[model samples]
Target: MNEQEKLLNARDRFIDSMAKNMSLYGITHSVGRLYGLLYFNEKPMTLDEMKDELGMSKTSMSTAVRQLQELNMVEKVWKKGERKDLYQAADDWYDSFTALFTTSWRTGISLNMSTINRSLKELHNLRDNPETPDEVRASVKLDIEKYQYALDYYDWLNRFVDSLESKEIFNYIPKKE
Candidate 1:
C-alpha cells in the first residue's frame, strides 16, 4: 500500500478502537463518533462542524458535547468577536480520566456510607426494642461495626486522594515487601 493509504488505514483503526473502548463506558455510538472526530481533528470544532463531520443529528451532537463537558474531558472556547462556541479535548488526558474516576468513586462511597449509617440506625432501634432477640441484636451490632470501619476507610481514601501531590501521585509505586 502507498504511504497515504497506510496512514488512512491507521487513522480508521484508531477511531474504531476509540469507539469500542468508549462504548464499554456506556457512551453512545454517536458520542463515540464525536469523540473520535474531535480527538483526530487538528483544531477545536464547533457543534455544527461536528454534526456535519460525524453526520450526526444536532440533538445527538449536543448530548455528546454535554456528556464530554460533564466529564471534564472537553473544554469550551470562544474566539474573539465570535458568538459560536468551540470545544476541544482536554490537554491532559490523564487528568480528565482522574477527574471522572475520582468523582465516581466519591459518589459511590458517599452512597454506601449513607446506606451503612441507615442500617446502623435501624440496628440501634432494634436493640432498644424489648421484643427483639438478643442473638439478632448482637449480630446486627457486629455488622454495624464492620460497616463503620469500612466507612472510615473510605473517608481515609478520599483524604488520601485529595492530599495527593500531583507529581507523587502519578509516579507512586508500592514498595516490595
Candidate 2:
C-alpha cells in the first residue's frame, strides 16, 4: 500500500524472476539473486552484504559466488583500501554466453559425438558381417548416411564454438541507444 512496500515488492519480484530464469538453466537461486542485486544496484557488493540481503548462509553465498565466477556471470573486484573482495555482474555481456557455449554447448556436442561414434562402429560391424541380410544392410547404409550428416553437423558446431571469440561476438552485437 505504501511506497516502501511497493518498492520492496518490485525488487523482490525482480529477484524472483531472475532466480527462476537462471534456475531453468541449472543455476542456483543464490547466484541469481546475487546477480539481480548487483545488476539492479549497478555496483559491486561484498559477500556480507549479499548474505544479509539474500538471507543465505555465508557458506552458501560463497559457494554460489564461486560457481558464478567460474561461469563468468560474476567477477570479484577490488576496491581501494578494502581487504574483502566484492562482486559485480560481468561487465561484458558476452562473458556468460561464451562460458555457456564453451562449457555446455561443447560438452553436449562431445557427449552426442561419443554416442554417435559408438553407434557408427556398431553400424560398421553390422554392414561388414557376412551374415547380415540385404534388407538390413540397406537400412544400415541409410542410417550411416544420416549419422554422417549428424557427425558433420557436430563437427561444424564444434568449430563454430571454437571460432567464437568473445570480442568478436561483442562487436557484432548491436549497441543500445
Candidate 3:
C-alpha cells in the first residue's frame, strides 16, 4: 500500500479500537465511534456534518454528541458566522480521565455513603436500646462496625477523587513526558 493508504488504514484501526474499547465506560459502540471520528477530525464538525460522515441519523448524532458532552469527552465550539453548533473531542486525556472517573466515583460514593449512614444510625440505636436482646445487640454492634469500615473506605475514595480532580495524584504517579 502507498504511504497515504497505510496512514488511512492505521487511522481506521485505531478508530475501530476506540469504538469497541469505550464500552468499558458504558458508552454504546456507535457513540464511541462518533467520539473516535471527532477525535480524529482536523476541525470541529457540525451535527449535520457528523451525521453525513457517520451515516447516522440526525437524532443519533445529537444523542451521541450529548452523551460525549456529559462525559466531558466532547465539547461544543463556536464557529464564526456559523448557524449550526460545532463540536470537537476533548484532546487532553488526563482531563478527560479525571472528569469521567471523579464524576462517576463521587456519585457512587455519595449514594453508598448515604445508605451506610442511615443503616448505621438504625444499628446504633438498636445496639444502645436497653430493651433489645443481648444476642441481637451483639449482632447490631458487629453490623455497625462493618458499616463504619465501609464508610471509612468511601471517605478514602472521596480523598482519592479529590486528588485526581486537583491533579495531585500526579505527585505520586507522575505522567509520562
Candidate 4:
C-alpha cells in the first residue's frame, strides 16, 4: 500500500522470475538467488550480505559464486583499499550466454577424449590376449574406429568455432529470403 511496500513487492517478483529462468537452465536455487540480487543491486554485493539476504550458508554462497564464475556470468571486483572481493555480472548478456553454451562443447570434448583413450587401452589389452574371440575383437575395433572418427569431427568443429566470432557467424548466415 505504501511506496516501500511496492518496492519490496517488485523486488520479490524480480527474484522469483530470475529464479525460475535460471532453474530452467539447470542453475541451483542459491545461484539463482545470488543472480537475482546482483541483477537488481546497484553495487556489487559481499558474501555476507548475500548469505544474509538469501538465507544460504557461507559454503553454499561460495560454491554458487564459483560456479557462476566458471560460466563467465559473474566476475570479481575490487575497490581501492578493499580487503574483500566483490562480484558482479559480466558486461554483456549475449557473451554470457555464449560462454555458457561453449562450456558444454568443451566438456563434451574432454569426455569424448577420455572415452577414446580408454577404448584404445582396451583394444591394446585385447590384442595381447589370445582368448578374445575374433568376432568380439572385430566389433570392438569397429567401435574404436567410430569413436576416433567422432573425436576427430568434434575437434575440427571446436577449432572452427574458436576461429570465428559469434557476431561474424551471425552476419554471414543468409536471410531466409
Best by TM-score: 3
lDDT of 4 at 171: 63
RMSD of 2: 2.6
Q: Pick the candidate with the highest lDDT.
A: 3
Clashing pairs in 3: none
What TM-score fits each model?
0.75, 0.81, 0.83, 0.64
lDDT winner, 1 or 2? 2
Tens digits of per-residue lDDT for model 1, 38-143: 8777788899999898888888888899998887778897788767889988776666666655666677778888898898789889878889998988887788
lDDT of each: 0.77, 0.83, 0.89, 0.77
Residue lDDT tens for model 2, 1-177: 999899878998988897887776677676788877877766788989999988989999999989888888888898899898999888765667577547777778999999999999999999999999999999999999999999999998887776564455445665455
Rank candidates by TM-score, best first: 3, 2, 1, 4
Worst 10 residues of 3 by lDDT: 18-27
Candidate RMSDs in order: 4.4, 2.6, 2.6, 5.0
Over 4 Å off in model 3, which ranges? 1-13, 16-21
Q: What is the lDDT of residue 169 in candidate 1?
A: 68
TM-score of 3: 0.83
**How well does model 3 score by local distance difference test?**
0.89
TM-score of 4: 0.64
Colliding pairs, model 1: none
